[model samples]
Target: MNTLRSLTLAVSATLLGACTTLAPDYLRPDAPVASAWPGQTEAVAAPVAVADISWRDYFADARLRELIGIALENNRDLRVAALNIEKAQAQYRIQRADQFPSVALSGGQSAQRLPGDLTSSGESTISRQYSTTVGISAWELDFFGRVRSLRDQALETYLATEEARRSAQISLVAEVANAWLTLAADRELRDLARETWQTQQKSVDLTRRSFEAGAVSALDVRQAQSAMERARADAAQYASQVAKDENALAVLTGGQVPARLLPEKLIDAVTALAELPSGIPSEVLVRRPDVLQAERTLRAANANIGAARAAFFPSISLTATAGTASATLDGLFQAGSGTWTFVPQLTLPIFNAGALSASLDVAKVQREIQVAEYEKAIQSAFREVADALAERANLGEQLDARRNLVEASAESYRLSDARYRNGIDSYLVLLDAQRSRYAAEQELIAARLSEAGNRVALYKVMGGGWQ
Candidate 1:
């Protein structure tokens, strides 16, 4: 019995004296971001890389600038994302609160009376008990570092959500801009089709008059009519597409069609070419909110791994309660009436069917997944920039080619019409030339639109136009 008692006392003393924590040490995982393009491509030009410019400077079109402003004000997707950020902020605050002591103010009052039989014993006992406490209740000592790790994880998550919101904003802005540009381009094409149809109508009327005067054959008049009908059909088709684009743009701008933008010869018709700002590529990472958002996600995942590792060891918590309890209200303030209790608890899971191991495994797996996602995002960003850059570089050459074709077609169309009037060529020749001119004009508009579209994409990839 003595031996057993001694052993019991020794174990209890050892447990009481044990103060060292056994939590796992946290380490940040290394994530490498690739710098260069993976595939063969046009050499990226070194430019004066300036960081973070306002959207207004990037897009000089006054109407487009106004549209972006309204979208920013009313975009539903962006608003929802902002609200998510607030929720994340709250969650982070809650998580951080766990690391500090919880102080509370409590007060209570109660009254009790003994039965009538107790009155005969000595004196009837009617007591009123009132208590009030304002003190720190539970404060985790963080000897195991669980609270610290959790707090770090929460902070990372908050930052990640913030980045996510920014990413959403970037995407929304780009979509709205792209849609608006498309609408403009569509309108331009519609105008081209209308002009082409009018030109063909004049030609048809001249051919019919010449045919009645025996200056041209019925076949010539029929060909002219066919060409006019085709032009009218193309114009109608373009108009339909324009309407659809307008509706889509309306939705993107938060469901309000403020006003229809009139078609112009080109995007730069209003804005001077000198005002176009093609900022450098390297500095684009900072300007592009999505890239930063992706990086934050990676950081959040890194912190999560640390949080999970910290869960494997013992947790130490210190709970101290101090209150005044008195036999009588008169003695409540006396030192003898004050009572205090200090409790220190330590919990370590010894065997839990491999639950801790499983959690660690899951966390590690998640980290790996996040790493892959981060790398992929980086690669995608680079590729998008590369595509935009290549397209921008080739745009001048493409425009030159299209312009030459348009000039040649317009001259050939005039020559063929003159020859038909002089009865030197069949109406088929005139029809062919007119068809070529119409196609060239429409294609040229599309090519220019593509150029503008590429810039928008580049802007999106570079991170929302400078800042």
Candidate 2:
């Protein structure tokens, strides 16, 4: 009874000391970065957060939402991230177990035979015995919070993995949207190319007629023919690009390309939540996943420092066993046949070639490194948001100018064609106008597409879709 009470007292004392953690309390590192982005803060009007809406609600295209769903369910990267969480969880279990005693069932059997040469004792004198005991074996008691610190580290790592999975989801959604946008744009350009080809074909036929009647030279006829063929080549290339981009999107979605994607229009892929979302710089630290992941990692690192520091102190462990052992099976359940033992151990490090000290040093350095990385992540996230917003505003202005150019080109081409037919303008004049009109039309398409893409990018930067 005294021994049991003494063991209990020791355990309580050890725990009292073990509960204190040596790691410094974690604080968010202050980053002295610029608050306002160049030419963006005051100049750009504050827009409502269009990115804050749920991805499904924002991306109203039923087909796009479906594709994103499939990718989230089947993406190999997400599965890997989940597996990593499982691994970290297992490690946490192992470390937690280290804080308590481990019990094992042990048995022993022996038979001794003596040589006949030693006759007095050897008269085939053999001894046989069997014993079995269930007892706690060697275990480390957490007397300095080492095991607890390790558990904290493991938990943080597990959460970090979860964040990584979310990050993958965010990136996967963005990629599918961008690729879908590209596919749609390519389709639109292909249609434009076909239109140009048809127009050029008409001009080519007219030139051929004029050439046969000696109204125009063979060189003129050849130039018109060349223009028509170029347009056909452009159309073919656009068709090929569109097909390839669709296949790429299909692969990401883990299926073959559908006959047609939903929304039927690229602009419908993403609905802007805000015409201009407010960019409050302070919230950026929490909004970005990579930044969150970095901070968690840093926290884990800080816990490791505590774990390493604890290694310099002694480890206290308590083990007790109460079981029955007897030579004969008949005596196994006897009332007074039980045996018991209690052991308390304390081990202090003596010498280890400075290995423990080196580990502590490494952990401290790693903590510093994570601090820097965390700061860098925050700065990088802020810059991406700034750049996206700048593009969104500037692209809007450029798009307006481009709209005017498209109209002017269309008018010039029409007039040039009439003048050429009336012999008031040369075929060269018509050719120049056709080239300018075609280029202008293509640019207009690109500008519109750019505006849509910019919105998606801004959404991503402003912490929009990961939720």
Candidate 3:
């Protein structure tokens, strides 16, 4: 009993001493990106970081907020991401369990018949035996921290999966917002086309009347009819685009969108997406879910190297049982029937055809790959933000210029129409002015849509919508 007690204490001490991991200390790789965004003149202080802001607060429209909420609940990709996290968690748990011994209780009975020549007493005999044991079978002791390192790797993998889910959520929210805005923009364009068609039809009717009365040439009536037909074609095209946009939004949201929640025009949607703050590149990129996921994956690879290193050392395992045995079932638990076993195994790598060394090399190479991938993720994130910022810097001025063009073209059309009515200008001048005004109106709608879409892009790249 004293020998058994000392042996148990010694094993416990050895296990406690093996707490440290063989993996190298983790150090985060430097971010491979520029310090500042291109064309950034100065640092801008923002009241709130993009990551700190919730999607609900970022979008001002109540209807848009509701739609995002519904999409969050129904998006299939998000559900898959969530399931992946669960699977990773289970895998981590399984790995962690390897660090502990698995104890089991077993009971059995056996009987054997012997012939007279084979029996010790030289007589035919029947033998019966009964036994019960509680034991841990072939449990690795983790003397070299191999099991610990594997558990750490699994933990990092689970964390990476969680970040992946966060990334999917961010993408889903941004996609829904962009799709909603696109539908609104298409609807606005469709309405503009319809309005232009109606106005052009009125012009065609007036020109035909003048031609019949000998006040205008037949060419003028044909020109007006041609303009009206162009508007009719645009109207049909825009109507089709609007329907396609609706279908896209329905697929993104995972179901048909409520009519009341749908956007009516770009003018309304322009106010739906709020402005995002330009945070420092390093701080913002680190907060991004995709970037964080990459870093976690790198950490997991680092842990794998430790496990590989541990594999080059000796491993120890133990298979132990404590039980009672007797010739009869009733005597199985008698004092004299008590029996015990303790088998310890030690394995040192003597020769393996270099497989162990090759495995360690592979782990090191994989860690290098993860480091590169981590840096790449940061670079990609930086580029996305920079692109969005560059667009945002120009979008305001572009929108203003488009509005001015629309105003100027509308005035030009009004003046030319008055001149043609008073016989001061020809119908050709009036026709050109009408065409310019219609084009300017359409361009203005496009500008508004561009500005709104740019804001959505900024929100997504800045990692604002996931919250």
Candidate 4:
């Protein structure tokens, strides 16, 4: 009873004193980027941060929302990230278990024969021994906080893994949106090509008939045929591209896309996506999951340095057993059969060839490496946001110019065709106008795609999708 009481008191005292670690006091590093985003502008009213907005509200397109939901549930990359979090959680639990004593129960029996020459009574006899024990084995008394530091490291690692999963989710949402938008743009281009082919075929037929009537040169018929074939080839190429885009979306969503949800035109898809607020600040990068993950890793490394420093100090352990033992099974539980043993061990480093110092140095170096990586993550995130903002600043003007070009090209084609019919212009002039109209239409579709893709990029870099 006394030994048990002593063990309990020793553990309590050790725990009371083991509240502090040798690790340096943690301080979050300042963000290594500009305070304001490039080309900042003031807003008349308060604007909401993208991180506060949910993806469901940002993407007004129902089909896009559905696809993102399916990707979150089915994407293999996201599934692996979630599993990593579970694994890390289990590892942390295992490390935490070491902070407390492990108790065990054991029972045993022994029998031996004694010859007459070896017996005090000069007789042959059999001796029996029975015993049972409940004890804690080699439980470390963490007077220097080594075990506590290790526990802290494991907890930080687990938290970092959770942040990694969030980062994956954010990336998955952005990728699906981009793929869906690309498919929409390609479909619009494909449709435009097919329409241009039909129109050129009609011009080719008209030019050939004019040549037969001796009203136009053979060169006119050949030029018209050439334009028709060019449109035909473009139509075929875009069709194949659209199919490839669908396949990519399937890979991202982990299943085939329904026809009803497929987009019809680039403009429709672009308009369906909500506009972002204009008052974003660079400070919002701190909330990004990748940046958070990097900081968590740095914290884990910092904790590891404490464990390394603790290794240089002496360690104490305790092994004690409380039980009953007797020569016979019936006597094992008797009053006099009570037996107890206590063992306390202390280890002090006398000389280890400087291995402990080397270990501590390694830990400090690892922490430094993590600090650099954390800063890099912040810088990369800031650059992504800055680039997206730069692109977005001009896409609206580019879209407007593309629309005007398309309109002017269409009117040019109309005027040239009328002049040709009235014998005031050559077939070559009309062909040039037709080609311009087709090229301008393709450029407009591309410009709309750029505008939409830029919006998605801004939303992602602003840390919006994971919500």
Candidate 5:
């Protein structure tokens, strides 16, 4: 009883000393980018903060929202990310278990026969023994905080993994939105090409009739036919592009894209997607998933320093058991059969060829590396947000200018066609006007697509949605 009481007191004293950790105090690294966003004055303002907005609310199109939902469910990358979190959680639990002792119950019976010459007795003898024990194995006492430090490191790693999953989700949402927008844009381009082809075909027929009547030369008819064929070729190219865009979107969704969810026209699709607010404060970048993940990685590195430092100190461990022993199975729990064992060990490192110092230095260097990575993550996020905001500042103006140019080109073509019909314009002049109008129309559609895609980019960079 006296020995057991002394053992308990010793363990209590060791645990009290476990509170000290060798790791240096953690400090968050400073942001390495500009504090304020550039070109903020030109950006549009909004009442709500972007991070508070849900993806469904930000993407107003019902089809887009449905597609995002399906992607969230079926996307293999996202599923793997979620599974990684589970795996990390289990790993953390395993590491945490080391902080405490594990008790196990064991029982066994043995029988042996001894030869007459080896036995103390003159005759051969049979012996039987039985025993049972319940005890902790070689559990560390953690007097130097080694186990605690390792547990903390594991916790930080698990947190970093969770942040990585969030980052994956953010990337997936952005990719799906971009793919859907691209499909809409290509579909619009195809329609525009078809319309241009039809109009040029009519012009070709009219020019051929005029040539047959000797009102226009063969060169005039050939120019008109050439324009018609170019438009037809453009139509075919855009048709192939639209199909390819659908395939890309389907891959993103991880399944076939439903026909009902496909955009009918680019303009309608652009109108359906709501514009994102710009000029968000640069400090919001700290909340980005990649940045947070880097910070967690830094924390894990810091915790490793504690483990390395603890290696220079003495390690204490304890193993104990209490049970019963007897010659017969019926006598196992008898009053006089009680047995017990207690072992306490301490190991002090003297010299190991500077191995401990090398380990500590390695840990410190790794922590420094993590610090740089965390700062870089913040800087990268800042640049992405800044670039998106800069684009948002001018995309509206560019789209408006392109629309006006398209309108002017169409008017010029209309006037030139009237002149050609009345024999007041050359075939070259009319052909130039028609080609200019078609090109301008295509540019306008491209500009609209850019404007819409810019909004999506801004939302993603600002850490909008995925809340």
Candidate 6:
């Protein structure tokens, strides 16, 4: 018992001494972009961190929030991402188990018959044995930290998978919101087109009456008819577009879009998507899911390098069994039949045709690749946020200009219509004014849609709504 105790103490000491890891310590890579976001000025007020904002608070529309909830619950891609996390967790658990011994209960009985020539007796002999044991199989002792390094790698990989699930969730929310906005925009366009068609129809009727009274040429009547037909075609086209938009929204939501949730018009829809604060600190990019995932992958690759380095050192393994054995089943558990066995092994790679060296080289290169990928993710995120900021800054001015243009065009059409009624201008002048007014109306709607969509883009690129 004294010898066994001394041996166990020595083993424990060796294990503690050998727990050193060869993996390089992890340090977060520097941001690959500017310290402050582009266009960020000293006058700009510091804003709340996007990561701290919940999706519910970011999206003010209750209906949109409900739709997003359904998408989160039922989106197939998000489901797959979640399942991947579970699988990664299981994989990590399996790898971690290697760092410790696994004991199993085993039992066996054997009987054999020997020929007369092969046996001590000149007749056939029978041999029988019975044994029961609870012991560990060949378990690597982790004397070089190989098993521990592998377990660390598995842990990092699991963390990376969890970040990937978060990325999927962020993307799903953005998609659902965009899809909802698209339906609203298309519905607005359809309404605008139908209204234009009605106004043009009245113009055509007046032109036909003038022609019948011999007050205008048939050409005037044909011009009005042409404008009316174009409006009718547009109305039909927008009707189709609206239906397609609804179908797209339904597909995004993974079910029917609730009728009550549908925005009645573009103006109403735009009001629902409130502007997000844009003066966020650049450090928030570090918390972006994709960036975090990339960093975790880099850490995992770094851990793998440690495993590869540990491969150069000798490996130690142990196998042991303690049980009772007897020639007959009746005596298997007898005190006199007690038995024990232990085997320890050491493996040194004296020659491997450069396999170990090659493995280490591969691991180092993989870590470098992951480092580059992590930087690239940060750069891409920076660009996304920058683009959104730039758009957000200018979209309001553009919308204002478009609204002014629409008003001016409306006044021009009204004056042209009055002139034509008094025979002070030709039908051609009235037709041109009508075309201008129709175009300005369409542009105004487009401008409004763009302004609204920019808000969603800002929320998405800033990594908002995934708290």
TM-scores for all candidates?
0.85, 0.91, 0.96, 0.94, 0.94, 0.94
lDDT of 2 by residue, 183-265 (tens): 87788888899999998999899899998998888888888888899899999999899879877887777777566563333
Candidate 4 lDDT at 442 equals 93
Q: Rate the local accuracy (lDDT) of all candidates.
A: 0.69, 0.77, 0.88, 0.88, 0.84, 0.84
2 or 3, greater by TM-score: 3
Report the C-alpha lDDT of model 3 over 121-169, residue by residue, as the tens digit.
9999998999998878888888778999999999999999999999999
* Candidate 3 local Cα displacement, residue 117, angstroms: 2.4
At residue 290, candidate 5 shows an lDDT of 86
lDDT of 3: 0.88
Give the range of the ten consecutive residues with the poorest summed lDDT in model 5.
267-276
Q: Which of the numbered candidates is closest to the native, going by highest TM-score?
A: 3
lDDT score at residue 460, model 3, on the 0-100 scale: 83
lDDT of 4 by residue, 252-281 (tens): 888998888788887544434457764445
lDDT of 5 by residue, 1-467 (tens): 35665786678677976466788899998888765788554434446667667788778688888999999888998899889889989999999999888889999999999899988777899999999988777888887788888899999999998988888888888888888888887888898889988988888898889899999999998998899999899999989998998888888789999899998787434433456555445447777788889999999999999999999998888888888999999999889897888998889999899999999999999999999999888888988888887788898798889989999998999999899889899999999998899889888888888888887777777777566
lDDT of 1 by residue, 1-467 (tens): 24433543454365436423332344433334334433433335335342254667667687887887777878888788889889989998999888566767665667899876777776678878766554555555665556666676677778877778777767776787778778887888888888888988898898789889887789878888888898899889988998898788777777767664433446744222332344434445544566566666656666666656667767666555556766466666776655555566778878989888888788778767876776666666766776776777788799889989999999998899798768788878878888899889888888877877776676677765424
Better of 2 and 6 by lDDT: 6
In angstroms, the error of model 3 at 167 is 0.8
Clashing pairs in 1: 52-466, 53-466, 288-463
Clashes of 4: 0
Off by over 4 Å in 1: 1-51, 110-128, 260-265, 269-287, 327-336
Report the alpha-carbon TM-score of model 2 versus the true structure. Answer: 0.91
The C-alpha stretches of model 3 lying farther than 4 A from their native spots are 1-6, 41-46, 268-274
- Measured with C-alpha atoms, the lDDT of residue 428 in candidate 3 is 95
